[model samples]
Target: MNGIILPVDKPAGWTSFDVVAKLRSGLRWRKVGHAGTLDPMATGLLIVLFGECTSSSDEFMDLGKQYRGVVKLGVTTSTDDLDGDIISERPVNWDEVLVRNIVSSFRGEILQRPPAISAIKVNGERSYKIARSGKELSLEPRPVKIHEITVVELSCPFVTIEVTCGKGTYIRSIARDIGELLGCGGSLAKLRRTSIGDYQVEDAWRIEDALRVPEFRGQR
Candidate 1:
């Protein structure tokens, strides 16, 4: 294959690079790249590029994203997700009306602070690295547009939300902010990227299948 655009359903516990590396080694391709980075805890659509497609990464990355996630109210964590240590806890006494209002408040463009344990670079190092060194890491909030945010379900401490947002939007930050507004700390309990632009997870290849069929060519 000269150049191919592969949509992969990235499995949880595997970094985005892991997918590219696996495909690169298995397919015996020299150049391989990914459009976006999904955290180790996140699972869903990850666009993999090959050969000439590698050069068009930014075009794919700039597209909007959609995610379905669960936010745990009244609980805060180090990484803003279940993968981190507990930082704080509080009581939950919020109703559906209040929850809906709070979640929907984030629909428009807003300044969002990226998680400290993110891959974002600070100074000359990764923010997560500085945080791991036991030093304070300050990250400035930047503008991110959330096209839509709907409450899929609200069950006590867990609120399931589906989000459609532009680039640079952090679902973890939305979870944290939602918790804060409800007067209770919160963190992301679950997250799955369902789509990116027109690319859907349903059409993506599973890691196992992709590795098993290296010769399979996908739409570019």
Candidate 2:
């Protein structure tokens, strides 16, 4: 059995499981899996493993990730992203200096709480499952290191950010925390993973294009 590693440009509205299912069908590989999960609302680089490539999954887990995203200030949601139920809306009044200070504060090591709608398992069930049931999911804050975080652009309600961070960092949580720090409710509006470790999104294949590659087609 030949093993192959492919970088995928996952599109929004598709779950990570959806990507795996499509790859399994297109590549005819029952053993296919993804190194990390990307939320349905987010799009970006996904390292797909097939056959013997699955053996190397551990090596891929530690890869640093880069993302570009927009956070909508003055609004809070249950899921910490646009897909969830709205929790509250508050007024936002920030000068450029205040925004810069808040962004800078999150630049290095920080403790962040995972969103309630995350896939993190608690007591053998997904946290999101508990959240959907209308139960409070009390997540503990964990330490995460941000390699770099730059405010790309700032508009009144929407702030664009480019982030490079260690593995396991949740960009959605960052948005939520930033909102708290600025005393304005906020949630992620859009997100895209630009890179994972050495794998750049620019070099990744779209799912359709990946399926058309000779080696992949031959497997089917």
Candidate 3:
């Protein structure tokens, strides 16, 4: 079968691999792969490569991604996002100006610690496995690039930002750090990827749409 690279708009409830599993079951041929993994809480553009397209997956994996997301102050969770258990809370003392300033400061190269419930590996197991076990799990901070971060909206408790970042950037970490700077814990409230490199979510197929009418398919 001829291969093709398909761009999909992954929904919030679906894991990256879930899309692959569904495609494998519903489509002809067998090879299916994704350029990157988006957490279950995230909804965004996911690149699905079939057969020969899978061989070139690395080409798109390093491209920068842009996201529109919300960071809510005064509350924090174990996963640094709303999907996890609330671990702490504090009164928000930040105004719009202060919040925008903090968000702007992150628009460059910075060392960031991946969230505890991340998929990073440690001692042969995913770090999130350790985190779910309620054990101590701390990963070293690594450098990541924030190409640009613009404050889109700010309403004291909720700060909305659009971020364009290089590979390895974590938007959740940005939310957590912003809250810490404001003296109130923060967690990611919402996220949607607008683009990845030249691929836009608007041009991607929704999961349901793909199942019924795939935007791209192989020629057998």
Candidate 4:
């Protein structure tokens, strides 16, 4: 296939590389890549690069992203998401007004620490690798911008929020922070990327259907 940016709706439980590998085999070719990875537990828009397009990652990687997620309050997970082990829990004491106000406070720029089980590198080794080895590291917090955070629903233990933020923002971090702000622990229960700049998940090509249709647009 030639060069093109293909929008794929990544399925949950599949690593970003899994989608790339699936395309590579089904298309009987190589040179496939993806921009802006989603965690294995999150499903949504994944922009894929094909053939010569693999060289254009920077174009999309820096774009702002949007995500809709559910934060499970009163519970803390090692990974900040359901994929990790539950480390602790606390009693919840929050109301809709408090939740809305707390979520709104996250708007604008803020510092966030990426989860230990993340792709971030420390001394050339993935942080997750180090974390899985039973070693603890005080990872530095990085600046990220949250343009907007809208609280969609508030039901005590479950808080749903939609976030519009810059490239480096982690929804899991937002959940954890929100929980901390409310004096209760928190973790991401579900997450889905709705958009990245101009690309929307609604228009994304389904991996299952794409594999069956041989002469897709990416074909040479």
Candidate achieving the largest lDDT: 1
lDDT (Cα) of model 2: 0.89
What residue pairs clash in candidate 3, if any at all?
Answer: none
Best-to-worst ranking by lDDT: 1, 4, 2, 3
Clashing pairs in 1: none
Candidate 4, residue 142: lDDT: 98
Instruction: Give all TM-scores, in the order shown.
Output: 0.96, 0.96, 0.95, 0.96
**After aligning candidate 4 to the native by TM-score, how far in Å is the CA of 50 from where it should be?**
0.6
The 0-to-1 C-alpha lDDT of every candidate, in the order given, reads: 0.91, 0.89, 0.87, 0.90
Flag the better candidate by TM-score, 1 or 3: 1
Report the Cα lDDT for residue 6, model 2. 90
RMSD of each: 2.3, 1.2, 1.6, 1.5
* Candidate 3 per-residue C-alpha lDDT over 32-146 given as tens digits, one digit per residue, 9 for 90 to 100: 8999888898998999988888998888879999999999999999999999899998998767777878889998999999998888899889999998998999888999999
lDDT of 2 by residue, 86-106 (tens): 989999987777877788788
Give per-residue CA lDDT, model 4, range 88-146, as digits (tens).
98999978898899999999999898888888999999998999999987579999999
Error of 3 at 124 (Å): 2.2
Worst 10 residues of 4 by lDDT: 211-220
Q: Candidate 1 has what TM-score?
A: 0.96
